[model samples]
Target chain A: RKLESGDAAEARDNFAGFKLIKVLNENTRNKCIFVHGSFEGSDDDAVVLMEKTPFDKQSISAMLTSTTDLKQVMQNDIYGVYTSSPPPDLNGINTTIIYPATDRHIMKYSAQQIYLINETAEEYQEITLPFIESQPFSLQWVYNILDKKAESDRIIFEDEDTDTGFILLPDMKWDEKLTENLYIIGICHKRGIRSLRDLGREHLPLLNNIAKKGKEAICTKYGVKENQLRVYLHYQPSYYHLHVHFTHVNFDAPGMNIGKAHLLLDVMENIEMQSDYYPKKTFTFTAKEKDPLYLKYKAAGKM
Target chain B: RKLESGDAAEARDNFAGFKLIKVLNENTRNKCIFVHGSFEGSDDDAVVLMEKTPFDKQSISAMLTSTTDLKQVMQNDIYGVYTSSPPPDLNGINTTIIYPATDRHIMKYSAQQIYLINETAEEYQEITLPFIESQPFSLQWVYNILDKKAESDRIIFEDEDTDTGFILLPDMKWDEKLTENLYIIGICHKRGIRSLRDLGREHLPLLNNIAKKGKEAICTKYGVKENQLRVYLHYQPSYYHLHVHFTHVNFDAPGMNIGKAHLLLDVMENIEMQSDYYPKKTFTFTAKEKDPLYLKYKAAGKM
Candidate 1:
């Protein structure tokens, strides 16, 4: 019996294109062979499946030994051909053939579109797409863009590709659950809304209250007064969400001093927000390993 | 004995016309009287001096007591009076007689002439004075004249009115006897000269050497490596002499960080040399605090 179908053709193409054949052959000693088949005893619309096995290899070897005209198909792109077989209880071979849709391709296309949307949204939030697209993505271009932006607006903070989901006002408070000594606060509103200004008269007060609460929590955790604590706010436009970030560093720790603390604070505050959407984010804060203050703060139980 | 004189009647008229009596009487409360005996010990000369003091005071005071008289004086409408008496020594006296010839007018005229000479000498180094009726005798004026000469030649570093003192470089190893961290090294010539280019070339090396030495000294004292030490040099133009000043801060110290250090170094290195005639004669270097690395080095005992 012979069976030919679009799903079978695709499975054959995919199997042929697979690059693990060398490893498979080396490991399995050419014992394995590729096979395309459809589900049996189902509706006659089952999709094809690709498989590799030793029996197919045996059959292929037997055919190779006996055949002459089929030499080319067995040489470079050799794959086993099989016809549907009935189950033991069936009277005849009952084969169900189904066409496989390009679901993976559809998924890949969707992912790409989502990524592009995210990138475009981020650029729009930063108001930099026009200028960024105007120049090549070179160091000089980046510097010029930054310089021009700096000239007009005072960027308070920025974070690129950071997980903003963890950036909640309540989470910003000092708590044992927060494994890291740092937290990011994202100020954002719905798209097309000026969240920062519209943060109503009550908005500032609410922010201030959050800051005050965070400060209190930090002070309580560190056993220090609010006055003793120093907070830095990073302003990032990438998040486009109106948010203020508060970070603290304790210099009284063993290796920590005001200088190192300040440096770390600066690093955290300067993180740039690069994502366009609200949730999916990536950002990093880097500092010297032996930052005297980090060690001091760690020793002081303040990290 | 009567002194022989030309035209006794004219002398009488001259004596009557004298304004000394009015001037002396008017100023007697604030001024002291001085009398000097003539060689012949003649009572007539003594009487003439006494009579003239009161007579001149009366005449001048009466005229000047009103605004109209003051305006007249401003207009230079009054005649100048001359007295034969010597100017009084005012050291111990509450009041003293002032001779017309020894008045402040003479000093003012001399100062004006000196100013003119200074202005002329600045353009042309060599200045010769023509014979003039009056000459300055005040020591203060003489100093001013010298200062003016120095300025014209561009040989003085008086940009800042700091204490003026020569920075002497003796042949000695930098030790405690010298300013703890202060020394001047001459780069071009072992001896200092009065030109900008020559001083820069010579002094720059010396400065570097001094800086190096300072670094070594600080490192040695603190048990740190020389390279780890930071030195700061503050150039003071008021002191035109070229000298290297050594202090604790590294080129990367807070205020003297890399950027500031480069800026200041550039300024010092590229300082414009004024005209050759104004050869700069003094330069000052002030030491600022040390850098953190040096401080660490000092603590580590590896300079």
Candidate 2:
């Protein structure tokens, strides 16, 4: 597909040739490499970001069959061994292993990039609060899933109760297997709840139910114990839907960092202590420089 | 030097032959490799953990000169280049560049190993709190530094105020430079206080002084802006002394994870909201399986 720079032009269905220019920025922590270039027959500049995806059990198991042209780099009693593949194999995959070939190596290589943001409670109110409130968010996807109009087959568990009901399903990022990287999302059935800020004591039952039933269902289906899971919610969630994230403790999933994530238990406790804890409490989070919210803060001279 | 297994025998300061028995566990995230083996002339089982240290400016600058026998692993218009050094160089350094040769690659490759531990507020009181309180902590080294009995030259900043003073020094792990991996610690003048749980409203002035003057001193000396610094304190600190950590925002220093680190700003806010917030709050953190606190939890069947 083609996108003309700064033209607001529609992308064409067919993609053409790509030309290499230069490297832009490579974030190793995030496992993403960005390069700037252009498409053939188009005079506009383009950027290509190649990111390493989280490894699922299937992909890890298939590595032995798919790996090829492995070349030994170096070996030592102290440093272990390093190996890399020089040529692209039949599957067009080039492999590299540092020190050892294990799942730990893969997990560390593909760890998510995290940015820590520190701001006063006042700054959050002046900049982030209004920005999140004014976002033009649509709930069509959430409604569709709740009404079973779309992705009905993906639902793992559901309850029809009005106040405390929620739909549980595997997060798109997950492979739906009983692996350490298991990820699931719980979307509340009740409406008008946008994000953590809107959470209150009245919603305790819903939150508790999601935590309780969600763990039970995962255990029943995947045999994952409750203690093995880390449940939390992102304050400045990507979307406005009220959703809870349930991931294995060992997974090291994205948005689990302190400034970005608030544990479900902590959230409930905060609300129990104060009915409007989330709303009254100050939150600190990171936003990309190019994000409209960040730009608004920049324009307002708050950041 | 060697010692027999299950014996409290002294060893002569002489090294002998070395052998690797087997690879134990490799943690990529932590950039550490563990192997079980034994040294030459020794009949005792030995476990060697090879942990990647943080890179300072000097080591990075020496890479070009130290790198040798560089071999191209793979190159593509889409994936960039991968390279490795087959032979150890004269300096005994082998090089490997996964995708691009950038600092981010090195930084991500050397991130710390973090474990997450979750316990209820009551569990912390019953297990971790008592464990820390009962610990036989000695502050002789801290006292020596404060009295200029030792390490006076290493002190970057110091204040003599009894209630709101501290001696700031470069953490030993740091390279003592103003690089992205810059790490500094502030040891409080007021003694008796231990970890985060011991903090209260009375310690507000001391904490505030550290946060304010620590940033100013670092900025004045290193030219690193206050915005580029992350000031926080470790809850389950390595030592019993009450010390605050000051690190460069770009540096992924160890113990800065959500469960381990508490931002100074957030700490102050929590205290302002409630005089005994830290004491009352349910603290969640990760403890090693071998930690005495973890053993206590296991004994209590709390985990």
lDDT of 1 by residue, A1-303 (tens): 233333232221011121110110000111111112222332222222111111121122121111211101010011111111111111111111123213342232221100001122343334333433443434432233234442223222322212221123322243434323434243322222222212232233334444455555555654554433334332122223344444432221111211111121222212221112122222111122254322333354433
Measured against the native two-chain assembly using Cα atoms, what DockQ does each of the candidate structures obtain, in the order listed? 0.00, 0.09
Alpha-carbon error at B273 in model 2, in Å? 0.9
Per residue, candidate 2 scores C-alpha lDDT tens digits across A1-303 of 343223333322222354545444433232333444455665655443333322222222232221312222321121212232212111121112121112332333332222345544576677776877787677899899999999999999997788999999999999976568989999999998878988899999999999899889987888776767778898688888799998876676766755677788778877887787777776767655566876776688765
Model 1: CA > 4 A from native: A1-303, B1-205, B235-238, B250-303
Docking model 1 quality class? incorrect
For candidate 2, the per-residue lDDT at A227 reads 67
In angstroms, the error of model 1 at A121 is: 41
| Candidate 2 segments whose C-alpha is farther than 4 A from its true place | A1-126, B1-24, B35-68, B74-81, B86-122, B133-153, B176-178
- Candidate 1 docks with a DockQ of 0.00
lDDT of 2 by residue, B1-303 (tens): 444222323221211243555444544553434444455565555543333333222332232222322223443322323332211211111112121112322333332332356666677677776887787644665787788866687789998898999999887555453356678999998887878887899999998999999889988988887766778888778788899988876665666666678788878987887787787777767655556676787789776
Report backbone clashes per prediction: 78, 3
Worst 10 residues of 1 chain B by lDDT: B68-77
TM-score of each: 0.18, 0.71
